[model samples]
Target chain A: MNIPKITFIKMNKKEYILIAGLLILGLLSYFFMYNIEPGAMVKIEVSQKLYGTYALNKDQEILVKDSKGVILCTSEIKDGSIRVKSSTCTDKICIKEGEISSSGQTIICLPNQVVITVINEKEQIDGVLK
Target chain B: MNVKKLTLIIISSIIFLSLIYFYMNRNIVVAQTQFIMNTTIEIKLFGKNIDKQKLVKTMNRAFDIMKEVEDKSTSYVEYEGNAASLNKHRGEYYMVNQDLIEQLSTSIPFYKLTSGEFNIGLYRTVNIWKNATDKNYLPSREEALNSIGNSTPDDIIVDKFNNRVKLPEDMEIDLGGVSKGYALDKVIVFLKNSNIDIALINAGGNIITLGTPVDRDYFNIAIQDPQSINKILGTVKLNNGQAIATSGSYSRYYEINGEKYSHILSGNSGYPKHLYKSVTVITNKGIISDILSTSLFLLSIENGRKLIEKLDYPVEFLYILNDDTIIKSEGFKIEYSQDNLYKDE
Candidate 1:
C-alpha cells in the first residue's frame, strides 16, 4: 500500500485564533442561534391563488389572499420570530409547518409558488434559507 | 502542571481543534445542491432568487409531475391517466401501491364516518361544480343527481386478483387531495437522492421541507387567521424532515345568497360544506398531509380527531371551529406569538 504525504505546518497565531473563534461561533450558532418557539414565521409572501387575499401565519399559514385573487404572503411580525402562513393552493403545506426562530430560515410553497425567508425584518438575519 | 492547569490546557486544545473543523467546513453552508424532479424531472438548486427563472423551472417541473398524475388519475380530465388505470380495476384489484389504495379505501370509511363529508368518489359531482364555476354551466339537476350516489365504495371493487380498478361507469375517482401530496413526496425523494440535504417543495400550495434551515433547527411557518385576510393567528415550528399542510374554507369557494361555499366539496350534498373554518394537519408524509387536511375539513372535528387517533402516522392537528374557537390537539403546542392577529378562539 502506498502512503500519501502527511505534513503538519504550524499555523500562525492569528490563523489559529481565527479558526478557533470560527468554530466557537459555529457551535454557538448551532445550539443557541435558533431557540425556536412555535408559530414563528420564516417566510411571507402575498399570493393571489389561495383566496381573495390570504395572510401567511406563524405556523407557516396564510389566512388571506389578496383582493386581486393572488395569494398575498406577508411575514407575521411577532416578538418571537417570523414564518409563512397562508397560500392559495389546495394543499396546505405551509400551515402544518411550525416556526424557525433562527436568523436565517425560510419556508417555500411550490403550489402558489412562493418562498418565505426569515431575516431580521428589523435587522439582517444571520443566514439565508438558501 | 497542577491538575487544574492540565485540565484547562486540554480543554483549550479541544476548542482549538473544533475551530479548525468549523473553518474547514465553511463553504458547506452555501454549497449548491443538485436539483431533481421526481427522479423524473430536473430542477436546479440556487439559494438565491427562489423565484428566479431557473428555480421557477424546477417548480414548473414539480407542477408537471402533479399534472401528469392528475391527467392519469382524475376522471374529470377524460384522458385515462394512471388514475383511470387504477380505477378501472376498482373492486377486485389491489393496486401495486397498496398504500395509496388503502389510503383511498380508509378515506372512504372516513367519508362514511363523516356521513359522506369526506368522499373519495363524486368525480361527476366535482365536474358539476367545476363546470358551474369554470364554464358558467351548472349540470342539469337530473345530471347532478344521476351522476353521483350511483356507486358507493362498497359497490366499487378492489380486485386483488388482478391489479385493476373497477367502479360503476357513472362513478369515477379523483385523487384531488392526494395527487399533489404524492407529487410532493416523489419530488422530495428526488431532491434527497441528489444529495440535496436541504430543500423546500411546494406542490400547488402544499409545502414540504427537507433538512434544517440553513442556519436554524426549526423552520417558521405561518397560520392564517380565519376572519382576516391580512392577519396571522400563529406560527408552527418545523424541524428537519417535517411537513405541514393546512385545509381551510377561506381559499376556494363560491358565494350564494350571502353564504360562501368552498371548493372542499361535500361528498353527500354534492356541494361545499360549512364545516369548521379550517383544519391543519402536520405530519411527515406529504400525501397524508394533503389528504388529511382536506379530509379533516370535510369531516367533523370529532371524527377527524378519531381518524387521526386511530392512525399512528405521527400526526398532530389544529382545528379552527365554526364558532372560531381554536382547538389544538394535546400534542399540539405551537407557540402563540405576541402579535397574534386573530382571536385564539
Candidate 2:
C-alpha cells in the first residue's frame, strides 16, 4: 500500500481579508437585492397605458374607464386582495379571473383590454418559466 | 503589505467582482402588449443577446398576423377574406384567402374528434342565444334547434386547389371557440421563426407558451373558481411548448329565473352543457386543447376519459364540478389550495 502525503497550506493574511471582504460584499448585495418589501400597491393598466395605482391596504372600488371615458370594468380591493367586480365586456373573463393578493400576480381582462398587476420592491420576475 | 498597497488591491478586486456581477445580470426581458382580435395580445421575449428593435418589429408582425387571422376566421369581421364570405356564397365555390382555408381545414377535423359537440357551424344558434342574451331573455328550444342546419364537417367543402370553399345553403360558420387558438398558433409560429426562444401568448382563456422562463422549469397557471370569482381552484405547472385552454359557464352566460344559460352549446341538445363549472385541457396543440376543453365540458367523466384515451398523446385535464368536487386526470400534476376538494380521478 502506498501512503500519500497531504499538504495543508495556511491561508495568508491578505487571502483571509479578501475572502472575508468578498463574503461581506455578497451578503450585502443579496440583502439589498432580495429584501422584498411586500407590495403595498396594486397597479392597473388599460389599453396598454397606466390606469392608476391604488394602495392595497385601502378598501375601495375603482371604475376602470377606457380612452373614450366608457366604463369598462369595476375593480374592488378588499382585505389586501383585488378583484374585478363587473365589466362591460361581453365575456366578463376578467371578473372570473378572481382576486390576486400576492406580488407579481396579474388579472387580465382581454375583452376590456385591462391588466391589473401587483408589484413590490423585490418582485421582478415577469412570469414563471414554462 | 503597506496600507496604501492593500487599499489599492481591495479596490481593484471590488471592481473585478462588480464587472462579474453586472455580466451575470445581463439577461433581460422585453415585453409588449397590443389590442387585437377582440382581446389584448401580450408578447414577451426572454434573452440576453437580443436585438431590441428587431424583437419589437417581430412582435408588431405577430400582432398583424393575429389581426389577419381574426379577419379571415371571424364571422363578425366583414372583410374581403372573412369566413362570413363562405356563408354569403353558400352552395357556391367562393374564392377565399389562404388563412381562411387553413383555419377551416384545421378546425373541421375537430368537429369529428369532439363528436360535433364543438361545432363551428352553429353560428345561427349562437346568434339566437346572443340576441336573446342581449335582450335579457332565454332562447326557446325550438328556435335553437331550428337554427342548426348544414353545421357539420361534411357540409363545409374545402376546395384546396382553387383556394375556394363552399358551405351548404342557409348555413353560417362561427369560429368563436377555435379562432383564438388558431391565431395563437400563428403568432407562436411567427415568434419561433423569428428565433424567439421564450414567449407566452394569452388570448383570454386560450393560452400558449413557446419556451421555459430563463430561470424556471415551468410556468405557473392558476385556474379560477367558477362559483366564487374571488378564489382560485388550483395551480398548474405548464411545460415548455404546451398549451392550455379553459372553458367555463361562469362567463358569457345569461341568468333567467335564477337559472344560467351558457354560450357553449352542445350539438346533441343545442343547449349549453350544465354539468361542470369549468373544464381545462392541456395538450400539445392549442386548437386541440381548445376543442377538448369545450367537448369535455359537455361530456360525462367516463365519456370524456374514453374520448381522451383514444388520442395518440396523453392529455392532462382538470374538471371542476358544480358541487366543487375537483376531478383531474392521472397525468395532471396540479397543486390545489387548501380550500379546494380535489382528487386525481
Candidate 3:
C-alpha cells in the first residue's frame, strides 16, 4: 500500500507582506466606513412635501401645514430638541412624542400626515420610524 | 515559488482586500421616508436581499393610500370627500367617502368598549380646548364643562345601506385619535398586498410592525421618558403583526404660568386628565391601541385594566406616573436601563 504525503507550502517575504497589507486595509475600511455623526438639524415634512429644515442649534417655531393651507401643527425647536407645540388634529399624538434630538429620532402626526425627523451631517441611518 | 505563482498570490490577495473594502462600503440597511398623513413616516427594511426599487415604489404607494385615508378622515380639511364636510352637514344626511365610513364605524365600537371613555363625538369639547390653548389661556371652566355631554357617539348615525351619515345639529366628528391608527392599518394592508411583510409603519407615537426584521427575533422599541423626552426609560420588544400606541399628557399640554395642562381630556369630566404622565398600549390593532392608550390615560388604572380585560384582543399596558413611577401590565415585558430611576409598580 502507498500513502500520499501532504506538505505545507512556505510563505515568502512578498506573500507575508501582501497578507499584512490586506489585513490593514480591511481594518481601515471598517473604521472609516462605519463612523457616523450625530444629527444636527430637524427636518419637517407635511404631506409628502419638504416643509422646512431647521437647525437643531437654533430655537424657533415652525408652523407646518398641509397643501390645502390648513395649519396642522406648530413645531418648536428648543435646547437642541424639536417637539410639536400644538396641533389642530384631535389626537395630538405628535405633540405627545415630545422632542427628538438624536440623529434617528422622529415625531410623526398621522392625523395631520406630518413627519418630523432628525438628520445628521449625512443621512446615516437606514430609516427612522417614530 | 516561481515569479508567475508569486504574482498570482499577490493578485489574489489584492482581489480579496478589494472585496472586503467593497463589502464594508456597501449599505447594510435601506430606508425610505415620506411625509404622509400629517406626519413624517419612515419605512426601514434590513438586509440587502430586498428589492430596492420595489420597496421604494411600495413605500410611495403606501403613502398615497395613507393620504387618501387622511383626506377622507380628516375633520380639519373641508374637501368634498372629507369628514369635515360631513360634520358641516351635521343636521342632514351627508354622503361620505367609504374611508370615512370605515374609520368612523371602526371607532364607534371603541366608545362602548371603553365605557364611553373613548368618545370621538367630543369634537365640541376638543374645539373648546383648542380655542383656549390657541389664545395662550385655559378654556373657562364653565365653557369646558358645558361642552361635556353635548354629543355622544350615538349622535352620529351611520346609514350603511345608503352609504351616508347624519350627525346631530350640535355634534361634530373628530377622528384625531383613531384616524392615524386607521391610516396605519390601511397602509399595513397595502404593504401586505404588495408581498412585503417585514416592515414597520410609525405614525408619530403610534407604531405598527408587519413582520420581524430579518436579523432580529423581535423589534425593539423605546418608550420615551415623559419627564425627559430625549431619554428612554425602557424598551419593549414586539413580534410580528404587533403595534404600540402611546398617549401622554406631556406631549400636547398647555403651559400657563408653568402649570402643564394635558390635552387628553376625559369624556366624562370635559377636562384634561392629569393622573398619569403617559399611557402606552401595546396590541395588535392600530385603532384599538390608539383608543386604549387615550382611554387608559383618561381613566384610572383599575378602570383601564378592567376595560382591557373585557377586550378580546390581547394587550399590555405601561404607565409613567407624574412622579416618574412606571406601572406595567403583567404581560408587558420591559427592560429598564440602569440609569432609569422609575420604579415598577
Candidate 4:
C-alpha cells in the first residue's frame, strides 16, 4: 500500500487583502447592477415612434397627438391602471378595452396608429394573448 | 517571495473572473413592434451572442415578410395580382403570387375538415356585417343567409402548377382567419433559416415560440379574460415549436340595437354563434392553431373533440363558455389566476 502526502499552502497578508478586495468589488458591482428599481412606466408610441413615457404611480391624463398636432386619443391613469377615455377613431375599441395595470398589456388604436403599453423593469409575464 | 508579482496575478485573475461572470450572465433580448396585418406584430429574439444591429435587420425582414403576406391576402386592398383581384375576377382564372396559391391550397382542406365550419369564402358576409356595423344597423337574417352563396371548397379551383385561382361566381374569399398564421409560419421559417433559435412572434392574439428561452424551459403566456380587460384567466407553458391562438368573441364585435355580435361568423347560419365565448387552441403549426381556434369556437365541445381526434398530430384546447365555465384538454396545463370569476369544469 502506498500513502500520499497532502500539503496545504498558507496565504500571507497581501493575498488576503487581494481576496478581500475582489469580494468587495463583486458585491459592489452586484448591488449597482440590480438594486435600483424604477417603478412601472407607461410607454405611449404613435406610429412606432416613442411618444412619451409616464410613471404609473402618478394619476394623470395623457393626450396623444399625431404629427399635425391633432389629438388622436386621451388616456387616463388612475389607481395604478390606465385606460383610454376617448379617441377620434370611429371604433371605440380602445375605450372599450378598459384599464390595463400589469406590464406588457397594450391598448392599440389601429385607426390612429397609436399603441400604449405598460412597461416594468422586471416583467412577470412574457406576453399577453387577447 | 515576490509580493508585487503575486498581487499582479491575483488582480488579473479577479478581472478575468469578473469578465467571465458578466459574459455568462449576458442574455440579450431584442424586440420590435410594428403595426401590420391590421394588428400589432411583435417579434422578440433571444440569445447570448446576439448582434443588436443584425437582429434588428432580421426583425425588419420578418415584418416585411408579414407585410408581403398581408398585401397579397388582404381583401380590403387590391394589389396587382392578389386576393382582392382574385375576388374581383371571380369565375375567371386569374394568376397570383405563389404565396397566395400556397395559402389557398393549405386552407381549402380545412373547410372540408371542419365540415365547412372553417371557411375562407366569407368576404361578402364579412362586408355585410362591416357595413351594418358602420351604419349602426342590424342586418336581416335573410340578408346574411343569402350573402353566403355557394362557398364550399369544391367551388374554388386552384391551379397550383400555373399559380392561378378561380372563385365561384357568387363566392368572395376572405383569408382573415388564416393569413396571420400563415405569415407567422413564414416569418418563423425565415428566422430559422437565418439561424435564429429562440424567438417569439405575437401577431394580435396568435403566438408562436421557437426554441426555449435562455433561462426558462418554456415561455410563460397569459390568456386574457374575455369578461374583463384588466384580468387574465390563466397562464400556459408554451414549449418549443408550439403555437397558441385564441379566438374570442369579445375582442371584435358588432353592436346593433344594444346587442353584440361576434366577428367570427358561422358558415351554416352565416352569423356569429354564441356556443363559446372564447376558444383557444395549441398545436404544432401556426396555421393549424389559427384555423382550429376559429373552428372550435363555432363547434360544440363534443364535435371539436371528434375533430381533434381525427387529426394525426396532437392538439390541446381550452374553451370559456358564456357562464364562465372553463373546459380544457387533459394535457393542457393552465395556472389559473387567483380569481373567482371563472370556474373550472
Candidate 5:
C-alpha cells in the first residue's frame, strides 16, 4: 500500500487579507451598533374618581385606570387622534371629546381617580407656558 | 521567516482585537441624525412636564393631520371633485367622505348641545376670514354679514343613511378652530403608547402636556394678558394630566381704526364680541377646552360661571376684561410671582 502524500493547503495572500479585513470590519460594526435605547414613562395619578373615556377618532377606545387597576377613563382613537369619549362624571365633559396622539397630550380622570397622559424616558420637560 | 510570521500574526491579532473594541462602542460614537418637522402653538397645559424633542415631533404630526383632515373632511372644498365632496341637492345629503361623515356626526351632537356655539358648520363665515386676500382686506359689515346668514348649524343636513352632507345655498363648515386641538389630542395618544415620559405639543399655540414637570413645583403655565400678549397676567400650577387652551381676542384679530375684531366672531352677530378679552379653560378634553374657551369668552360671565359649575372639570378660568380687570373663579388659582413681570388685577 502506497501512503498518500499529505499536502498543506496554503491560504492565498489576497484571500488571507480579505478574510482578515472582513472579520475586523464586521466585528467593529457589530460592536459599535449595539446600543441601549432610552426609555421613560410618565404616570399621571388622580385624586378623584373621575369618569372619562379617551377615543382615538371617537371610535377606538382606550380605557384609563387607577393604580389599583380600576377603570377611571376610556379613550377613543380616530383620524390618528385620541379623545375622551364618555364619562360617568357629571360634565360628560371628557365625553365632549378631545384628541391626543403624542406623548404630550393628556386627559385626566376626575371621578374614578386617574390622570392619563404621555411622557418620555427623560423626565426633562422642554417648555412651560410662562 | 519565523520572526516575520510571528510579527504578522501579532499585528493581525492586534487589529482584530481593536476592531472588536471599536465595534462595541460604535453606537456611542455615531450620532443618528433625524429630520423632525416642527410647528409651535401657544397653549396652556395643566399638570404635565414636556420634553422639547417630543413636543416638536408631535406638533409636526399635528400639522400633518390637519392637512389630512382638510383633505378628507366632507366640509372641505373639493378643488377636485372626488368621493369626499359634498353636494347640496340631496336635501342635506351628498355622497360624503366616510371620515368627514363620521366626524361631523360625532361632533354635531356637541354643536346641538352647545346651541351652535361649538358648531363646525361655520364654513361660510370661516371662509370670509380665510378668503381675505391681502388686498381684499376684511369684509365690510355688509360683506361679513352677507354670507354668514346661511351658516345655521341646524341647516347642515347630513343624511346618515347615505353618509352624506348637504350644505345650504351659501353655507359651509369649517373645523379650523377645533382641528388643531383634535390633532394635539391624537399626538398625545401616540406618545403615551410609545411610553414617552414627558412632552408638550403646541400647534399655533394650542398647548397639550404629556406629563407633570419633574423640576417645576407645579407645571407653572402662564395665562397671557389678552390686552398685551407679551405681558402675562399670572401662572397656573398643574401636576398631571390636564390641558389648557386660551381663546383670546389677541390671538386672531383684524386691527382697523384701533378696534380689534377677535377671530372668534359670533355666528349670530356676524361680528366679534368684546365680552371678555381672553378666556382660558383647563380640562382633560382638548376640544372641549378649545371650544369652551371661545364660548366662555363670548358668553356672559354669569353664563360662563354657570357653565364651569355645570362641568366642574378642574377648569380654572382667567377672564381679561375690556376694563383691564381679571375675573377668576373661586377655586381658580392664578400664581403671580414677583419675577413674573405683570400686574394682576
Candidate 6:
C-alpha cells in the first residue's frame, strides 16, 4: 500500500520578516480599537441632539442653551463630577439629582429636554436603574 | 514551485485569512435614545454580523412599538382607542385596541394578587393629585378621599372577542405602572423575531436584557441609591431573558407646601406609602418585574414577602428602606460598591 506524504513550504528570512510585521500591525490595530484608556468626558444631549462633550477634569460651568439661544440650564463640572447648578425648568428635579462622577451615570432634566451622561470609553456599568 | 514563490503565496494567504477572520468576528454595538413614555427609552443592539444602519433601523422599530404602547396607555393625551378614550366612555362598552384589552386583562389578575394595591382604576385620583401638585397646593383630605372611586379591576368588563372594554362608573384607568414594561416585552418579541440576540432595552429605569453580553456572562446593572442621587446601592448581574425594574419614591415626587408626595399612589388609601424608598425586582418577564416592583413597594416588608411567596414566577427583590437598610433575596447576587452606605439586613 502506498501512502501520500504532506509537504510543508518553508519561508525565507524576508518572508518571515514580512509575516512578523503584518502580525504586529494586526495586534496594534486590535489594541488600538479595543483597549482605549478610560476617558473622563461628559456628553450633554439636549432634545436628543448632541449638544457638546466636556472634559470632567475641567472645573467650568456649561450653560446649555436651546435653539433660540435661550439658556436652559447651567451644569458645573467640579472635582471630576458634574451637577446641574441651576435650571429654568419648573420641576427642578435635575438640580436635586445631585452630582454624578461615574461612567454611565446620567442626570436627566426632562422639563428642559436635556440629558447629561458621563461618557467613558470603558463603561463600568452597562445601564443604570434610577 | 520555487521556494521563494511558495513562501510569498503562503504569507499572502495568511494575511487574507486574518482579515476575513477579523471582519467576521467584529462585534458591533448600536445604541439610540429617545424620550418616550414621559422618560428616556434607550435601545442597544449587539451583534457580530449586522451593520450599524440595520441595527439602528431595528432600534427605531423597537421605539415605535414603545410609542404605540404609550399612545394607547397614556392618560394625559386622548387618542382614538387609548386609556383616555376608555375613561371618557366609562360605564359603557367602548371599542378599543386589542393591545389595550390584552394589557388590561393581563394586569387585572395582579389587582387580586396584591389585594387592590396594584390598581389601574386610579386615574381620577392621580389627576386630582397631579392638579394639586401643578397648582402648588395640597388637595383637601375630603377631596382626595372622594376621588378614590370604589371601582376595582374586577368591575372592568373586557370583551376580548369584540376588542372592547367597559369600566365601572367613575372608574378611570391609568396603565402607567405596566405600560413601560409592556412595551419592553413587545420590543423583545420584535427583536427576537428579527433574529438579533444580545440586546438591552432600558425604558427609563426599567431594564431588560435579551441575551448575555458578548464579552461578559451577564449584564452588569447598577441600582441607584434612593437616598443619594449620585451613589449606587449595588450592582446586580442579570442573565439572558431577565429584567430588573425599580419603583423609587425619591425619583418622582411633588413638593407642595414644604411637603413631598410621591407619584406612587396607593389604590386603596389614595396616598403614597413610604414603606420603602425603592423596591427593585428581577424576574423573567418585563411586565411582571414592573408590576411587582410597584406593588411590592407599596406593601409592607412582611406583606411583600408574603406576596412574593404566592407568585409562581421566579423573582428576586431588593428593598432600600427609608433608613438606608438594604434587604435582598437569598438568590439575588449583588456586588456592593466600595464605600457602600446601606446596611445589609
Maximum-TM-score candidate: 6
Per-residue lDDT value at B327 in model 6: 91
Estimate, for each residue in B88-177, the C-alpha lDDT of model 2 and write its tens digit.
Answer: 777888999987888788778767776777677888888888788678777778888788864576678999999989888867888887
- Superposed on all Cα atoms, the candidates' RMSDs to the truth, in angstroms, are 16.3, 15.1, 17.1, 14.9, 20.9, 14.4
- Better candidate number, 2 or 4, judged by TM-score: 4
* Model 4 chain B weakest lDDT span, ten residues long: B19-28
What is candidate 6's lDDT per residue for B1-345, written digit by digit as tens? 789989998998898788756754467778889999889888989876677788888888988999998998887789998999999999999999877987898899888888878888888888888888889988877777678777788889999999989999978899989888888999999999988898999886799999977656898888888868799878888999999999988788877887888889887877888888889999999988989999999988788899889888899999888888889899889988887888898
Please estimate how well model 6 matches the true structure, expressed as its whole-model Cα lDDT. 0.86
| Candidate 5 per-residue C-alpha lDDT over B71-171 given as tens digits, one digit per residue, 9 for 90 to 100 | 66434456332222553342445676555655556466555545555656566666676566333566676776776665466777777787657777666
Off by over 4 Å in 3: A1-130, B1-28, B34-38
In the range A13-49, model 4's lDDT, one tens digit per residue, is 9999998899779766754443112238899999999
Q: Write the per-residue lDDT of candidate 5 for residues A17-100, one digit (tens) a residue.
A: 999799868775664444322213333446744334332223455666556776656656566555667666776656564654
Pitting candidate 4 against candidate 6, the one with the higher TM-score is 6
C-alpha DockQ of every model: 0.03, 0.04, 0.07, 0.23, 0.11, 0.25
Query: Alpha carbon lDDT of residue B73, candidate 6?
Result: 88
Which residue runs of candidate 2 sit more than 4 Å off their true CA positions?
A1-130, B1-25, B255-258, B341-345
Model 4, backbone clash pairs (residues 3+ apart or across chains), number: 0
Q: Which of the predicted structures, 3 or 5, would earn the higher DockQ when compared with the native?
A: 5
Please state the error at residue A44 of candidate 6 in Å. 30
Ranking by TM-score: 6, 4, 2, 3, 1, 5
lDDT of 1 by residue, B315-334 (tens): 88888887767887777666
Write the residue-wise lDDT of candidate 3 on A5-99 in tens digits. 97978879999899889888867766544422247888888888898888898889888877888889988999988999999988988888887
The model with the greater DockQ, 1 or 4, is 4
Ranking by DockQ: 6, 4, 5, 3, 2, 1
Can you list the residue pairs that collide in candidate 4? none
Highest DockQ: which candidate?
6
Q: Write the per-residue lDDT of candidate 3 for residues B1-345, one digit (tens) a residue.
A: 699999998998899788766654343344566776666777664333355676677777887888888888888889995788988898899899888888888788777777777778777888887777677787777787787656678678999888899888877878888888888888888878887767777776788888775435677777766777667677778888888988888776767657788877777667887899888888998878888889899888998888888889899989888887788888899877668878976
Model 3 whole-model lDDT (C-alpha atoms): 0.78
